[model samples]
Target chain A: MLKAPALEARARAISKELRCLVCQNESIDESNADLAHDLRVLLRQRLMAGDTDQQAIDFIVKRYGDFVLLKPPVEPATYFLWFGPPAVLIVGAVGALLFVRRRNRVRAEPAPLSAQERQRIDVLLREPN
Target chain B: MRRILFIVPIVLFLAVVTYFFVAMRGGYNPSVVPSAMVGKPVPAFDLPGPPSPPNYAGPPVKLGFTNRDMLGRVVVVNFFASWCVPCRVEHPVLMGLGPSANVPVVGIAYKDKGQDAIGFLNEYGNPYVAIALDESGRTGIDFGVYGVPETYVVDKQGIIRLRHVGPLTAESVAREILPVVRALQVQP
Candidate 1:
């Protein structure tokens, strides 16, 4: 553990973003797997060696790739992974808006009655008396 | 136009379903992590050899190997441990690689006891040309090993060409491992 509380906190924050390769879902900070333990130690070693946070993370990413990160970096290859959900949401929202507008337009104006239909309504009203 | 629009959502839903179906049928395993070491030089590691068994008279194959040892020829490196069950299943296939493909197979005892690793080799038949003992698994981490029984194929230049993440089967040996080794061997 770092003697400095600030440095230890910084390390903790960085570790939470790192995925435990063995457990998959858990972060290295939360994982009990031996590999995760080793990674935690390696991360601390890098920090003590005067590596910046990005450098320490990059040291791992160089070996494990972007999958080791809980949040993937925005890049051309991950364009879809990052933007796909919001794009789908926007498309769905637009389609729903268009559907609602069309329905309201249809409801706002009734179709004009034919002459015969008008005469039938008049006859029914006359018989009601 | 309205009818076509009405079918849009259904079409999109089916497209999503078809994608999942195809992926499932293609045997997509979510657990398989792609190795980042491929196409890069093997990580630098100089590991010590596991302790030899008492009164054992096998060839001095227990001498630990290093990255420099990988130079000048094709080599197959396997990460394994006695505690790993799958390693047992893959042991026979590893034994066959040296004879069949004529590539020297190097072994790294990942996080296992020297005695236990020796016992495993004795029972399964030692397939390694040189065995490196990684008791702390620092070398395993350098190699990006998440688990035991991983394998790598290194070319003559000491560049890692391929990494197989799990235990090797006979079929995988023939299809994935042998072809890479063969191609690398013939390269000028």
Candidate 2:
């Protein structure tokens, strides 16, 4: 067993990032399933072998797909998952803002007087009625 | 324009809800993860142990499969165990593979005790050319087998073409597995 505190802490951090495939909703660190245990052991072995954190993660990701990672890497396949909600929110907010601003601008602006209307106003002013 | 904007959020919400409702109709098994090994060559390692006699019986050809065993033919590799209920459910469908379907099904009994495997096969007929015992689950990890009752369809060139998770039902067999096998066998 790897008893080094630093290694143990790093292993824990890595395990938490991995999803236990048998228990879909839980992380490998928290799962008691055999597959999860196997994964946890593999992660620890990699860490103790002086592999960097990303290297350790890459091993797991290669074995399993991005689905095994709780937070999958942002790629063409998953672009929508990562940026989609924020993109929609920003687009909707900007659209609504533009709409509201245009409406308000229309309400605030005074109507331009036509030539005939100006002439009628002048006549009314002259007659003082 | 402003009225349209006012309805946008509701419209989006309805679309999202409709997607989920339609998706749920296919049924759900959250534990399944798409196998990464699909499209890749068969994992290199000799499957340990030999197929059990009488119950876990099939063609008398081989005891266990190696990387070389998969060449020159389309085959199905089934990961199963006695403990898994779903494996039992799918066993009958698998039994038809060898004699009826003319497709060799390689079995790997994952993390199962040997005698229990024999007992399981004795109770439920086995449809495997050979049943290899993956005692340590290293082979399972190599094959990306996270759950039991997962099946892989390999092409003649030893490339994995399709992965089916969970039990093989008659519906899934006809709809998913059979069509893929038929297509792969033709031409290339």
Candidate 3:
């Protein structure tokens, strides 16, 4: 809603990063909720007033929790959120690698010859044909 | 040692399965994300009063609520509106609280027009001791209200002790809200 294109673009960028509290997954820029509109306007105002992006974001987050941020920062609260997936993947890969190595080790081991097998081999070697 | 390694994958698989079962049976609703404001001080906001309700015989509450007003008192702050069906459903339960609980029930009409907000109160006998307006939805956002009829219980020190999302059912009042409030009242 800013008259200046630069201001409008900045507002849009910030809005996209903020989640619409009323909607399930929509960002503020995309949402049509009354709260979202207020947020968009607020963001524009803050930018126009020369607040940095992070400052504006912090102001909003200070009021509404980190929930309003679309991508929450990696903090104590969101450590699991930020790292839970990679940790799972690493664990799974390690387990799989260990399993594969163990299986290959088993396959590489030579089976000891049974007495019957040894006798049959000797008999075959002794036969002319 | 070799045999144990062979059993390791099976053990790990079973462990994962058991975890899933335990977690699923834990019964935590995914939709109800814990409010960030829980245990923290209520957000600071001072809103202007909306127009007085029509056909209501009483004067309006205050200009608005700031975190200061909430200090040194136990308060039940309810976010509601005329358009919200859940708010209507929760009306009788809110009314039921005043006479029995002997507590102040402060209502903030969330994102509603002045006329409609007042009309809703008129339709459902006003249970709130101090009802105000959040016509711009700014105050509701500050409270982290995703929906209407969500109630919060604040302690004497202005710390948010509890938050009840959605409409308050009778079961919720007796089981959850009252116990917390009663405990907080006796609390220093």
Q: lDDT winner among the candidates?
A: 1
The model with the greater TM-score, 2 or 3, is: 2
Tens-digit per-residue lDDT, B81-121, candidate 2: 88999998888888776565567888888888767776787
- Candidate 3 residues B76-115, lDDT tens each? 9999999999888989999888667777888888888877
Where's the lowest-lDDT run of ten residues in candidate 2 chain B?
A: B50-59
For model 1, the superposed segments whose C-alpha errors exceed 4 Å read A112-129, B53-59
- Tally clashing residue pairs in candidate 1: 0
Query: Which pairs of residues have clashing backbones in candidate 2?
Result: none
lDDT of 1 by residue, B41-106 (tens): 999999888777423445558477789988999999999999999999898899899889989998
**lDDT (C-alpha, whole model) for all candidates:** 0.90, 0.83, 0.83
**TM-score top scorer:** 1
C-alpha DockQ for predicted model 2: 0.61
User: After best superposition, candidate 1 residue B126: deviation in angstroms?
Assistant: 0.5
Q: Score the docking of each candidate (DockQ).
A: 0.75, 0.61, 0.47
TM-score of chain B as predicted in candidate 1: 0.91
Clashing pairs in 1: none
**What's the TM-score of every candidate structure?**
0.91, 0.83, 0.81
